[model samples]
Target: MAITSAGIGSGLDINSLVTQLVAAEAQAPTARLDRRQSDLQLRLSAYGQLKSSLSSLSSSLGNLKNFSTFRSYTATSSDSDVFTASSSGKVSKASYDVNVTALAKNHQLSTDPTLAGAQFTDVTDTLSTGTLTFKFGTTTYDSGTDVYTGFVQNPERAAATVTITDSSLEGVRNAINEADIGVTASLIFDGTNYRLSVSSDDTGADNSLEITVADDDGFTNDGSGLSLLSFNGTDNDLLQNEAGVNAGLTLNGIAITSSSNTVASAIDGVSLNLKTLGSASLNVDTDKTKVKTAITAFVASYNAFIGAVNQLTAYNPDTNTAGELNGDGVTRSITSNIQRLLSNPVGVLGSDFTILAEAGITTNPADGRLVINDTTLDKQLNDNFDKFITLFSAYGETTDIYTNFVSSTDDTTVGNYAVNITTLASRGDLVGSAAANLTITGGSNDVITLDIDGVSASVTLSAGTYTAAELVTELKTKINDNTDFSNAGISVDVTESAGVLSLVSRSYGSSSLVDITGGNGKTDLVGAAATSTAGVDVAGTIGGIAATGKGQLLTGTGVTSGLIVEITGATLGDRGSIDFKRGYAEQLGNYVDSLLASDGFFESSTSSLKGRLEDIADERTALADRLNLIETRLRSQFGALDALIAQLQNTSSFLQQQLSALPQIGGSNSR
Candidate 1:
């Protein structure tokens, strides 16, 4: 009988045989595909690590790429008890003798009912309902007489009004405190009755307080009801506790005054904070430690980046093994390009200092790392500090002091660019046709409205102004003090020559404009037939190419594209030339940025590897399908062979049984 199972039919193990044959057919090709996929994956990982190292190096090179990072200064004061100082930007290195004469003080006033003998009993005692208006200005007073003599309203501070919804004393105090209008109000008790004290938030001679009241009792300054709070140049219902005063100081024997204790305008790029009355010597000098530290950081980061490259492309002969990116053409090219760029010299920076090697920064031949010589570097920094900075930072040197190198973009190249100015920039001005009226009467010709730089504001000049200088000063103060003009960063310079007044906008360019719009004082202060003219922009060229001009800045085009320079001189001809140089840090930083970009070296290499890996996976799938077909065919062939053998054995058994039956007769006959 033939067996039902595959191998049992012919006494052969066909299932095991088919399995062994399929494995043999699939082994070589499948292993090959798997090895290819693994190699591609390793290469992709190496590229990622290399990208990370390059990015870290790029970030570290940011500060060193700019010249401003090396222009740091330190201001040291001999005695900090009297004053402390700090400096920034390009400041002159010099010693200054500063003497603090006095500190700034704020104005304080208190309601003294003892003069009138009308003291309240409790905090909730009702005063009167009315509006209290606060104005800021300068005031002159007679100490012996205890009376105010004159007042000049400061245009910088706007008047603030507070309403008394609650007539109680404590209620008025809370309301005044909540106004937040540059003043603080509080209730003070001097071991007796309580008094309300109000003080100015600012400390200056021009920041004195003047309180006026619109009382509900129809008397604004009669020392009755809400009128008791009135204190102005004429009325003194409140007693003055302290007068506002400016800080006084002498810088280098020159007298200086500031509204606050922190003074910033006495010296260029330096700020001084006064503490007490005394003397101190201040010295400003270049900070060298910061420059050295920046250079050291650049070296360390470059070394780390090169170390990653070395490991990624290294071959270990001891184990007969190599790295994933070993022998890669892209990797080799990157290394060679970096080395070439480092060896090249910067020519635009002049001959004395150009290359990193001149500044004691040399590369190691054995390990491909940066090595700094401490002694040599210190000598270079001490001897040629400015040249040392130009070695690793982007620097520009100009021939003319007035024509400054403002800035440049990455697209700007190294070389000299000549500057030429066709027209000088000017500011808008309004000149009066005749002399201004000296006398300014209140409610008749004291108010003036003006339009400056497209902004409009009305300023009320002080009445009773006579001298030409005083009128000019008053006009400038009132016009600059307007909130509308100050908020928009617009101002005007007022000057009077031969009794004629001129108003010029502080800003330059075609957008700068000033005009007398409307007011009763328009015809009196600056005549009705005044001339108004708008400013014109500066016109110039750089590197023989017509540049775009806006105010004082001039930008170049063509080969000198992205280069910018500022023309501060009034000359209308050839100004000078700017010698721009791209240092080592800038060149390397740009190169690294290109290599790590989206369409750059690392991205392209990793993408190709990923594609190859995907192809390997497809090859593995095809191999699996081919192996499955082969196993099916082998099982079918083995089953057929086993059946054929079983059939032959059955036939032999039948024949043997027939012969035995026939052979029994022959054996009996032969016996």
Candidate 2:
């Protein structure tokens, strides 16, 4: 190792001087880089604030984009404990008196105690070897006759059966459980004996069970066998624990019956869950408080966003300190646009209800936070609820071309569509045309089975000779006469025009099919020209892009996205469009989205600032490298000078010693 010292030979601190010189050389450059780095880092932080505030503002605008959000209402019941109700904004504000007469009950039946006593020990023990089938049906009561009708078979679900062997009853129960059928089985003890019981999982009169037990051992359940578990009157062996019954209630003096206590479809958008037999007055109304709360949240989020922006772009006169984005054009533009939007009134809605100010929402002059006038808002909501809803939602004006136009959030641009319909939808029809002189005849034994919708009904004709008009009248009367078809909304229109008779379905979809089957030999009687035509779908294009048409409705996606206009009239070529306009919330949301999206200007600006920061970092690293080189060169020069000075000192010391020795001898003569 080489030794280093200061002022050892030349009486000067050369090492210290070299260090001071190197530091002086590095100071200005390092200071400059540091200042640049600090400025870049501060600007990056400011960009982060911008991103966060914009994101927060964007997130808060989600629910406000829908007008339904403002139209939302809450339902209240006078007896909340007995019944609870909820609304989905579609229901009108009305007071309805509801009487919960009875709740639905499940049907349950248990086997006879005498039969249970015949069972062996252990649940694994089986009593017979056969299969037990279960089916569900309903029973209606004839009040006039005072008799209950036979259980009507409903063939929607096939009967579920459980096969039994000489095995444990527990195994049988497990098998039934694993089947995941509608019914559940278990062993019950009735004080003296344990009986096998089964129950229907669903409640209602239509969910009553019919259990049929069949055994290969010839054990017939003639009122005494163990294979009988049913609610039929003849089954005296089994005991009925409970009878399935429908929930009966009255709404505003109107008799209402439901299969279950949870009745949702009975009302347009309200779910009524009956709890007990009681009366409750349900007052459905517009929940203005909830809408106000949502509006308040939006205002708060927006204020927070603007607050962050102001802080990032503020300038302090005393400290002569300006924020990072104070002079940025984008920041100035963003501020101006938001302020303008917030100040302006929404003019689409009428003059009376245009803008937030008219709706009782006003901005604070100091901070731009929205403040609501509760009383005024309540009055507006009560006076004109629909108009208030239309304020935040785009309502397209119907034109001669299109009738029902629905605008959504994706409907950003306002324009019309030149619709050209190449084909219009046609309903399926059966033409029963015969020879000009043929007369339709019907016998008493002749049965006409008509299949409409997905249900079929048969009617035995009365013996008569009928004309084409009479036959059409009879068919229409019979189809509408059936209760099932009427309840299923099935209608058949039979027309006789120009000596030709035809039957057409009222529905226009592909699922709307009508078949006339089982006429026996009546095919020639009705004159074999009976035929069906396929229903055609409305096909065309909208806004130069191919549109999807189903029946009378035409919808477009992509270029014409959110375009849903129903074609009610037959305009073959160039059907006009409904003009769509954007609402206030939608416009604001779109602007915010543009500012914060992945390819947004905020991201671009942040990237540019970070790039400059990277450049500053590189300059700082280079300054450090130069300082190292300068220190190395200064140490080398000082080291050489120290060596030369040390050599001179040594030479001088030797000469002094020689001179001292010679001076003692030359003191008297010559030195």
Which of the numbered candidates is closest to the native, going by highest lDDT?
1
What does candidate 2 score on TM? 0.75
Task: Mark the regions of model 2 whose C-alpha exceeds 4 Å error after superposition.
Answer: 1-11, 114-126, 140-149, 166-172, 223-226, 230-236, 318-324, 347-352, 388-390, 393-411, 415-553, 556-561, 565-579, 647-667
Candidate 1 positional error at 183, Å? 1.9
Q: List the lowest-lDDT window of 10 residues for candidate 2.
A: 435-444
Of candidate 1, the 10-residue stretch with the lowest lDDT total is 113-122
Tens digits of lDDT, candidate 1, 631-669: 889988998999899999899999998887774655657
At residue 244, give the lDDT of candidate 1. 84
Shift in Å, residue 37, candidate 2:
1.2
Query: Candidate 1 — which residues are off by over 4 angstroms?
Result: 1-5, 116-121, 142-145, 348-352, 429-506, 514-532, 652-662, 669-671
Error of 1 at 30 (Å): 2.1
